[model samples]
Target: MSEKKEVKDQFIIAYLPDLDNTQTIINNAICFAKMLNKGLILLYISDKAYKCVSITDAEILLKELSSKITGIGFHSYCAIEGQTKDIINKIPHLLSGVLLVSATEDKTNAKVKEKLASNPDIMLKNLYTSRIAYFISSQNLNSNLPFNKVVMTIDNMRESKEKVLWGSYFGRFANSEVIVYYHNYKDEFYRHQLHYNIKFVMRMFDNFKIKYNLHLSSNSKTFVDYQAIDYAKENNADLIICQTTKNKSWFEELFTLKERKVINNSQQVPVLFVNPREDLFILCE
Candidate 1:
């Protein structure tokens, strides 16, 4: 008998009760997984308060999902688990590499009953605070693939390079146009420094042969998060990639709050949050 090949890292998709947006989540996950040459894992969890679904049912559903993604030149698996919070906490330790892609259906026009049937925001908060490389799909996506226009939000040139490095991979892989947006605030010295950093990142992009655009806002405008959201909408961007603000201390908690606001205001576009510590070399060919 041949020894089984151990799957190290995977792109995981959360399967909710309605499953209305599973295909969109799967499409993005597959594109990312194929780009990284990693496997895909479909994860389903049963809600105790809603339908009395068992692990068996979740497993069966996963099998059906597996059938749709088979022979895609990558290994795929299904995991039927309980409690999304627990799973999010343990994933980093359980797998060598993992990217969680979560999709939330839009309920703006749904009837009251249907709105009540959707998943709660508790797990969503957990995912954001977990510091994992994750993507949260906005509510009203048209279920498209190979995102043609992508936006990358950068705070400083120091961190902008990292953002560009990761964003370039998606741009090159999807053959998408990338726009780099930065907000100019604070003092001239800081603004000048950020511009230098942006230049540095642009140079790196040029060297890598990655095509992209740059946008910088003046300090007289609104909040940075709002500006970024507006720019994405104006461009009809399919995805917005951003780096989480560095967690320095209690004083820096505002960055986290701003990030949440940006996510909420994304207007149904997918947002990819890349952790600073994650290794990009493995993700790039």
Candidate 2:
């Protein structure tokens, strides 16, 4: 049998209706679909029985969402499964041919009281393990603006170079300029490390020929993620690209907390998290 490749190029937006940012997610997904020249798939995983009592209700909601948006039409899928299991079992199959754009709720004191932070970590792990090109859209982002300025944040991690390459790919697709942001610890001992990181990132962008600016933040002792976000916002970034760490052990815990901060901040921009190990096979095809 031939490969079922039709869904491969679709852009999946995991929509949660109870969340206030449903429209933002849809709009962001639409913009991304246009930028990537891919189809849009609006997915809602209904965990509550009351939300979608029958398949008919799911279908109706899908149509309602589709009618509100202009330009590209949406392919809708709603799975009546538990949220945890739904993410684990259905996402891999549903996202077989498409990239994922996760519209997650911004973390706030209210959400914390409601205990929503733990779930986002689970979703993050599932997406990372799937090794797909995925992004977490800021709940407050203005998706209407063009992706003319993209910011890629680089740390000392080995995969930082790959993040730059992915950033360049996105930059080219949107016909936008790429800005590489590197946060260097404010210590003289790390000065050489900063230079090394810059050289590596530059080499990755060498062949892409996409206009890019390299910005370094050297004086920082606390709030690393905040500094990165502040820099992106200062430069009027439309999209921010960063790499996702494997969800395991202390590193995963720290990364999840740090990333959650970046995603929920006042800087409302889509943050694309690429798995460094994943090859550029999808892009080449």
Candidate 3:
């Protein structure tokens, strides 16, 4: 009798909306899975309940694809038949984990993209469950993986710690240097908050012996997210770590524009958006 292999509880979910357009998403997912030493899930969501791909076929395809990868510990496929909203709502309960990877470019129409950009609730409906999401941009379709440099943006908010944690985590796993960029706040209250956040990040990195650089932005007029993205582009950074919108009213969330710009930046640097929550998912070694 043969023994079944045990998979790790922490894994990366790569959502593939179309089988024909799987290369970019799969490549990026494999890169992350290998770098982080986590299992990989090739997930496909289909609205055709009766005509969706069968488990047998999906498994066969998954096996063929997995054969090409070298170091991934475990890999599997999941085909869900449901509306987009229903599937997004059920994902966290079914696959609670540290990270989710999805490509930003889809086959959707222009109107849909515009709507999603303006309304972050619909665009990132899944991350509200406190899942860290990495959205691969189209400009980085062929970029190399195992990021060499990671840029993290900090603001005058408690959520800044989450970005720091993720940036340090990536530095440990991928051996990438982290750039901590903070906005130059002039308000006394905001400046005090930023100081504490920067102090905490410095202490954490110093204790862990992670390689990092601090960059205090002089351009106070520009949005922090845009500044981080610009710095990453100019410095040849492979990834940017930032937080999603938090404590916003319905109107603010509906018109949330920073994340949309960062995700679709012309520089094409990949973004890892960490949602602010009391209980955020942490990756285990």
**Model 3 worst lDDT window (10 residues):** 113-122
Descending-lDDT candidate ranking: 3, 1, 2
TM-score, one value per model: 0.78, 0.76, 0.84
Please give the clash total of every predicted structure, in order.
0, 2, 0
Candidate 2 lDDT by residue in tens digits, 1-285:
012335445445554434334677677777777777665666655455222234456556666776676776444545344554445344545554346666665555363444342245545644555445676765565547488888877666566666665676665787788877766765666656667777876776676667788776675565544676777778787778876654446665656456655666676656777665644324433
The model with the greatest lDDT is: 3
lDDT of 3 by residue, 44-135 (tens): 66545322465456556656665675667777767666665566545555664457776655323355433231132344553444444545
lDDT of 1: 0.61
Instruction: Give the range where candidate 2 is weakest over 10 consecutive residues by summed lDDT.
Output: 1-10
Model 3 lDDT, full chain set: 0.70
Candidate 2 structure, TM-score to reference: 0.76
**lDDT-best of 2 and 3:** 3
Query: Model 1: clashing residue pairs?
Result: none
